[model samples]
Target: MKKLTLPATVPVKELAERLSVSGPELIKYLMGNGVMASLNQSVDFDTAALAADHFGFEAESEEAVAEAAPASTRRRHPLLDQSRADPKSLVARPPVVTVLGHVDHGKTSLLDAIRETAVASGEAGGITQKIGAYQVEKSGRKITFIDTPGHEAFTAMRARGADVTDIAVLVVAADDGVMPQTEEAIQHVRSAEVPIIVALNKIDKDGANPDRILQQLADRGLVSSDYGGDVTVVRTSAKTGEGVTDLLDMILLTADAEVEPKADPKVGAVGTVIESHRDPGRGPVATVLVQNGTLRVGDYIVAGQVYGRIRALLDERGERMQQAAPSTPAVVTGLSGVAEAGDVFQVMANERSARSLAEERGFAAKQQQAQPVRRITLADLASQVAEGSVKSLNVIVKAEANGSLEALRGQIEKIEDPNVKVVIVASGVGPVGEADVNLAAVTDSIVIGFNVRPDDRAKAAADTQGVDVRYYDVIYQIADDIAKAIKGLYEPTFVDVFQGRAEVRQVFTVDGRPAIAGSHVIDGRIPRNSICTVLRDGKQIARSRVAVLKRFKDDVREVARGYDCGITLEDFGDFAVGDVLEAYTVEQQNL
Candidate 1:
């Protein structure tokens, strides 16, 4: 049979042409396999493989074919060829190591023991504030270590395309065994395709159980070399400073076996920005891992949108360094702006060229930012649910009263899915505020309001941050909506659009009924029976629809701006002079 090579994804027409089959015939074959696609629609490698097999051909991914291809040239170090580096300049560089594990797993303590920095004592609650790269000498060789908080920070950097880690030291507490965060760290390093050396920490404690920990590791597919596996397990106690040297030796051994052994130090310095922040004393500063060449003081450098000549180079200890060599981490000052984590930095020829390059990159970044950012919408969560990757449906609930708040929290927490969990990251009683929206935005959660509404600042923040804000007057509707959304069976079309705001000038009641607000439409027109929130003293007291809208003696559909009108709201009768009435229409969203 003829063999065919294909990319990771190919359109139906393109795949058909490559497989020597007609487009309709390929479509027919795809339909027979229960896949519905047009000729121009793209299909993944597996789908393409099925189609190719039906056409009397064997399909292999382009990557698989390349791996089996004959060598045409000498294999050069992957990092060196980027700079057109001279082979003579290539020499062994220190391996960059990242310490990752669960919180309270002694990762920071182990680093403090190795580097002797006492950083864990100064940190609030012993959690590292941020990730920074530093180097420590083991015997005659040096190894760079990055003190990361957890797997979240680890994967966040890789998502930006920086592949800096050479080896991963997974610190698992002997007593804690395999924690959720430990599993997450393992998953991240495996995805990054780096070598791992297990550091079984906290061995000196009475509760430490190394055997159970090792068994847990074996269960997670990280069997020890004693059991015919490649993983190296080193026992260490950060408190007593035991087996620290052996772990370092194992790191060097793994680096020799895994990382590219040589780098060209004679070339211009190119590195990744580990993390950057504003220093009150030193302006914009960044901890950069020098990957390929020497980074020197006064060198012009450009990282993403920022460019500046380095005024000073400081080590992780705050000590001054004249230059940073390959595999060294330097805290650099004098950047034009704060570079983001994982931004690749390179030394430029001069200030002029660096500024030009920075400006060009800044423009391109802005253009890319125009694309929609990934948000944790119900649709997005539903897809993750299908893949069994979604761990939690985080929610921020805000209701009208404390009783209602408790009720909503109980109902939302009771929702259970075998694949995904429902977690209330934050909940409170009141109108949704800006802080609530911000928390929801960072946590990728939905902000649900029951019998309450969000303020103007929160509304704007939700829109800008792409946060999903839902308002429901009914209590059980919240849980019902979430359940349907997770199963991909529910997508409500009703979306809130701001109508207008009105200020109360008079308060009265007709026929001893609910209080009515005689007000002036200050901004836009207030539609009849639209969602209206009554606010007093800049705080929302009630969220409901306008029960009645009128102008003088004539009942009107809406009251326009610069006009006075009479308005009555549902579920709210208490009216105070100078209270603001905000209106919004519930319209069907296009998508």
Candidate 2:
């Protein structure tokens, strides 16, 4: 029997048409193996290999098939080598660019002007609301623009050390020269190390001053092209469309100087998510940029924890696109859950395989959590190291607000010793409580509390359980003490004894469980089962039992100054994130 042959590349729509299946139907089939794609998106040869397997065919390589097939059969697959064609030779390849600037700096207006211009020239109007990537042709050259909101989202990717941008267009309003966000954008672009073209926007406004903007740019080390500097700065009014073409021309020149890599459709697909969000209509929607491989409809994909077949692929203009390759960003529908923004995505073989890989990853995460962490104090660290115990300093940070929490966390993470590292077991914005104490107790870690205190019952519980609950209003003190602890230079200063002044930070309500109060060590280490008193407004509120003591959600022996713990009250309750927990121990003076 003569063997039936398939083309290496087929139009995404044509495949569905030939198979009498909808675009989404073909996409679902492709996605079974972990290639997230949509109907309009094109699938390459390797992807077709999987699709052919689904159809019960022994998939053959494109080269092998080409050698076996007659010339008449080869012409049917026109989309196969389009992406592999020379990037410079192909006028169809759109230049992907991102616009970045400060808030209210006409960043949106510039994009609006571009959209308006394209529409006025007979392009579609529905493209404006799409995520910043879109195709616009200027002087018959295709250009793709990514309209990022500000440096926050721009740098957010860099925080993960991923550079997904090809070119960065720094939008600086002529009237607003060198704002904080502008400097931030400059820093982000520099950090990203991508080529940047400056847009001196809103030039038609009354307050416009291009010269001042240029001077400000010089202050930030950005020397403009017109001033013998390498940076290209274009002054334009988005309202009047003046200098827009000049800006586009400069971008084209920049792109011409830098060659973009073309992908081999025969290889497996690897991509990155430009954006992702949860939608009511769709479970998880992600905007993906195919950097080096071909993505087709129905390709199964793995992005972070989510795994699903490509249900749909929407372009920046909300139009269904057949295929996306290098520099092509498309909105993909069909993920198990919302993947984090900037997560790397790749195509897999089948739905079952993709699900298996995802499940394996999930199990691995659980296994990681189950793995034991070594805790070495300053006194025991050297001996432990000699005994082959190398571990990080496990910590639980409790703060009053998000900013302080983040700031302190960043500073603590900046402590760069390999032997001594800081691992935040759990952190939240609230008062230290019983849960914190219990966690610390188990992990043998200290919980640091900032601008918050613990309650009466929590203090007694911490005292009874010997869990540490440390409080600090100043951030440097916390960092310094942690450093000292890591270095074994931590001294029990400030009375080397318990006077019992402490505070509360938070209270946690575990479902179907009793309430746990989060508290801090205000003054002196609250020793286990020490005599304690509960004072509210300098008066005895109630005397209760010390029910539990926890550190980093783990049971621990004790906690010292500048630490936090979780504690349960014996009888009294009513506690919150910023209440004080005072503890006391009788000082025995031997003569």
Candidate 3:
């Protein structure tokens, strides 16, 4: 059978030509299959596929074709987009790796086994609370590992900047196999275009089958080297340390050859703040991963608008250190204020220079704050497309729970627009805040809050930074708004106004087509030409416009409370006694 590839939506005539069939023949085929479409009209992927099946051809969409390609042929991931350092001053540095996988897939357990620490007990729910960076010595060579929260919501923070991970160590359970978060992590790692090493964890568990897990990985396009693919798969038991040593060996081997994680240590210190917070005793503290050069005590550094001299540097063990080399994580205490989690920290020549640069940045921030918030509207999307300023709509979503956030993210991801990609930058459980607004402003993203409200400070920051913060109580509304905005397909938004209701007293047929619902206006008033809804036992069953209204054989425009009226529902005849006839008007508003 012939194979045909089509877009998400294809015009009828275009599809006909591709199938070597006439437009009328295609339309007839659709009609035979209970689908109606004109030659110039469009049909969705499902419709096209159905018609193609009838025509003896296998159909696939462009997205499906792209997704079917080997993982090695995929484009470099956006998270791994790090600029190279000066080769003249470059020295071999430990490869910074990140462990990402599905929740409860033993990501933390694997880390604990590697670090030989009990950090999991400190977390609230056995899940990693925040991003943690650690360096381990293997065979006298160091390897930096960034332990990201395995939950799906934390994926947003991983996409902020590149050079974050030189290699991604995907942890998959030997029995449980690849999951939703695993797919999410794969998308991120692919965007970074970094080498991957699979840790088939939980080999000690009952029913564990490493081969089955490898097959699942292969289905996801990650073929292992044991099967002739370049990707390495290491079977490991985080509890028993079985194959754990080999995993480390593979990491070091991959880093030495495939990743070559090196930086210029002789230059000024430049690194990213993996996490930051306020310490009651120390005032402020930032956990930073030095990507280039060296971070030392007494060196004045500027991060965002916060600037200060590094008074002390502490390693992952909380011990004071004098300096942190490239790929090393350090807890620095000396920032003037709390910096952002993803902010880049760079050492300046002196405290004076640092302060000067910070003042300038602070002024710029104030100016941004003075501007009006940038709302994502259809007109804005049109302008952006016209100017070629954007090809994707980057969004950060915050919700009240992980389930809601995940559901919202899934729906948002499915809003297909061939012109613009909908990129959910990050999603987590919480009210929207200043941190969200700050990230949105820097990345030209919008903040979407589901069943959550932003605090006063977050609102103020959003207003100042001109960041768009939209909140929604309904999940479908969020999807609808984004679809309209990105596709330039705005419809009249309707607000239902309660114009009173009538309880059905009896039902009479009119010409066996229209049903007359004899009802009494129990409250308020029921006006003519209003949209009517049939409520059966407090549940709405159908909605239609009021076609006819009468009071004792006199045509009336409305019936007030305590009065009886005869109402004929338009295109609806199903009426039962004890049913309610609700009348309301649709209030349309502009987008």
Decide which is better by lDDT, 1 or 3. 1
Ranking by TM-score: 3, 1, 2
Q: List model 3 lDDT by residue over 1-591, tens digit each.
A: 445677899988667645544466788889988888986689999999988888766687778765875433222222121232235666798888889888788988888787753231232234322337877767878888886664222334543332467888999999899875686577556655688899999999998988888888897789999999888999999999888789889999998888787777776677878888998999899888898778899999877679999999987766678999889888898899998766767777677667766665676678767775555444466467556665888788889998998899899999887778888765667888665675665556778889999999888877666676878899998898878767655443568889989999988986666788999999889999999999987899999999989998999999999999999878788899999988998854322
Best by TM-score: 3
Q: In lDDT terms, which candidate is top?
A: 1
Model 2 stretches with alpha carbons more than 4 Å out: 1-93, 119-124, 259-261, 366-591
Displacement of residue 484 (Cα, Å) in model 3 is: 9.8
- lDDT agreement with native, every candidate: 0.78, 0.66, 0.76
In model 3, the runs with Cα more than 4 Å from the true position are: 1-85, 117-131, 151-154, 158-163, 227-230, 375-591
Q: 1 or 2: which has the higher TM-score?
A: 1
- lDDT tens digits, residue span 1-591, model 2: 101244667655445433323455567776777777754467776776566555444444557756764542111122222322344433324557789887778888888887767642256476645764666777776676766666656654544323466688998999878775676567556645578899999888988889989989987789997778989898888889988878888887887787352444443456667778899977788888775457877898876567889989887767787677666778989889887775666677677656655665566557756664332233343344345454666677888998998999998887776567777766767777654564454445566789988767556545544556678888998778777666656655322234555577778877736567687886776555554466666667665555666888787655577888887666666665666666655532210
Local error of candidate 1 at residue 573 (angstroms): 40
User: Which pairs clash (backbone N, Cα, C closer than 3 Å) in model 3?
Assistant: 76-191, 77-191, 77-192, 77-193, 78-191, 156-425, 156-426, 369-464
- Candidate 3 similarity to native, TM-score: 0.55
**TM-scores for candidates 1 onward, in order:** 0.54, 0.52, 0.55
RMSD of each: 14.5, 16.6, 19.7
Which pairs of residues collide in model 1? none
